[model samples]
Target: MVSVALAKPLDPCESPAPFSLLVPVYRGDSAHRVRRAIDSNTHEQTRPPAQVVIVRDGPVPQEITDELDRISAASAVPVVRVELEHNAGLTNALNTGLLWCSHDVVARADADDISYPDRFERQLPLIEAGADLVGASMHEIGDDETTPLALRQAPVGRSEIARVAKRRNPISHPSVVFRRSAVEAVGGYEHVPMAEDYWLWARMLHAGADVRNVSEPLVGYRVSAGSYERRGGPRVFLAEMALQWKLRRLGYVGFIQWATNVIVRGGYRFVPLKARETAYRFMVGHRNS
Candidate 1:
């Protein structure tokens, strides 16, 4: 007979570490998905967040606003809403949300994704263990959340993560829980089009931030044919080129690395849709195996 080991239950006497949840929502998000995302992280999780900060990047529809109100009233913990008059884009919205977070440790969640009940139960201890930034692998799922597509794995350990970041993003942004002080110390997130999170991770790595990634999947990331289609096109390729240039100027990557990354990762943005999806699936299978 073969035995499979399971994670032990958290001690009841030892209260979970306190951390704030930051979720930024925009006009395009669905009200139902937003509510589900917040509920999963707050009321449904084994370890609920101390506070939840929902940043309204711009004015959403009345239904979405009402949902936010209901979320605040029904939440077990404090929920703060930071409203911006105009759509300031993701980088601005994220920076704005960071200011309102009350705890030193902040966990990020997307408005459309669902977090596993033990997500924080698995991640918070790493933050308590002195890691400046911690992220986890995620299971890419369809809209229903039942259909699994691929496993996106993040590199583990400080040295390995740093080496990988020189060419590609090493952490899953939505599955991350990072120290507020550490992020602010590196000047917070900057404008990098679709690559803001990657840029921030690169900057943090260059600054010697202690980073780690849980090998197991903790978040259910939503993916679709539309998601794959959006990955390509001239605009996204330009964004990729801009990020590679930024990394080179920051001295985070050597000239050869920068050029190679530009050719490979940047060229990926121009691949045919079917080919791109197949390549992604192949990479996912190769890594998860």
Candidate 2:
């Protein structure tokens, strides 16, 4: 029997995970946000990543390019930039970036997210201990990092993650540090539209990967004004439906479960905007200080 070594309750010791930071940046994203995200990784970090892999997901603004160059030059940690000719979307861009990650573990970061200084140090031991996919909780920052709107917690341990994932996305995408080989073994991220991370987790959980999450909030996820609108609408609903179908096809869910999932999620999306907003607030848990 292959017993997985799970992460112990964290102590003060700084242990960096053997990993590369995977960040995909494009034109539409905030260049300043990208700089701050990388800056967060560079300071107060007890264990910095082996390399920060930046995937240029197409032609970004000249300002973003300059910021990347500036950040790279200033970083004490190694930085690898992979330039793609055209925009391949997040899933494709991530898949492309992973190929260049030399380390076994890969920490994910979005261009707009603000990672806490000790984030990777907290997760490194978990990945080192045998977690194939490890994520941490997050604060959904509204106006600023100091003014967080909600505490979006994730399930702890593999079984908990598996259970929670069956219902909804249990891992905060940006808070995750996962094994590159394990991802590759499961065929990596799919080309799903809005459900890319969810789809990947479903597949990984189904494949029996040892997924876990630390209890601490390691990143502050920025929420835009149009977040709810962008997350709703017919297009998003159809994408969720497609994800369910794919999940069912992967044998992760039975036909009945798939149908139920579609109905449940679809209904949730269609609820009155205010009610949906309330539920989102509820799901995200308590407000952050």
Candidate 3:
């Protein structure tokens, strides 16, 4: 008879499962927010990452680099740094950082966002239970970073996630923790400008990866006035069209769904700045504060 050993159950009291926190910084990112991002994802987490991989997309101000150096030196975990000579944009930068992660599991953090203390503790166990990708709902905060603006919720369960991906991105990127192998197998974040995360989720869902989302909000997504403005504009509209076309070509969506997306999502980009912000808040369930 052949004997095989089953994996031991994870103990809640033990140290967190090993994972690498992946963050990409660019010239436009705020230095102070970056420091807070690094601190929250590491020191404040109930279950902290075993390692951190930060990718400098291009040249940043001396202040940003100095802050990064100071914070990284004080980090509890080992930090892996990668610098690109020129701006390669978010998609490329993320792909480059993905390669340097020391752990099989990687948790993504945006420089402007803040991950809650229980973020990792909540998501890690789902990964252990065979979820290739796990994301959570996020609370969108205003410029103050303390006032809640709205709640961006993600679909839970594999079936719902796959269904939602056919029409829209189901995962919250900043609140995600995914297996590196699963993501790399699907070609590590295809270039889609503003829609890179959506493109990735669609490809991974199509490939039958087990994706899930926690119902509780795990991250504070910073939403400034400029942030809402970026959602519209000509360049963003073109990017939305490109993403829709790519999804259709991949057989992830039919012509009807594609046209609907272009009409709905693409059209949203052409609206006035203030109107777009109002509509967005309504769509995401705006909070009074």
The candidate scoring highest on lDDT is 1
In TM-score terms, candidate 3 sits at 0.91
The reply for model 1, stretches above 4 Å from the true place, is: 1-16, 282-289
lDDT tens digits, residues 1-289, model 2?
A: 1223333433457554457889999989888888888888765566778789999999988999999999889888889999999998999899999999998788899888888888988888777766788889898896578777778877786677776777688888999988887787778888888888988888777776788889989999998777776767788888888888888888888777778788888777888777777777665454544
Residue by residue across 1-289, what tens digits does model 3's lDDT show? 1111222445668765699999999999999999989988998999999999999999999999999899778877999989999998998889899889988889999998999999999999988867788999999885666777678877787777777787677888899999888888777888888888989888887777778899988999987657888899889999989999898888889998889889988889989888898877665545554
Model 3, position 229, has a per-residue lDDT of: 86
Clashing pairs in 1: none
Residue 191 of model 2 has an lDDT of 87
Can you write out model 1's per-residue Cα lDDT over 1-289, one digit (the tens) per residue? 1111222334657666689999999999999999989988998999989999999999899999999999988888999999999999999999999999998889999999999999999998887767788899898887777765678877787788888888688888999998888888788899998999999888887877778899888999887669878989999999999999999998899999999999888888889999887775554432432
Alpha-carbon runs more than 4 Å astray in model 3: 1-16, 282-289
- Between candidates 1 and 2, the one scoring higher on TM-score is 1
For candidate 3, give the lDDT of residue 283: 58
Q: Is candidate 2 or candidate 3 better by lDDT?
A: 3
What is the TM-score (0 to 1) of candidate 2?
Answer: 0.91
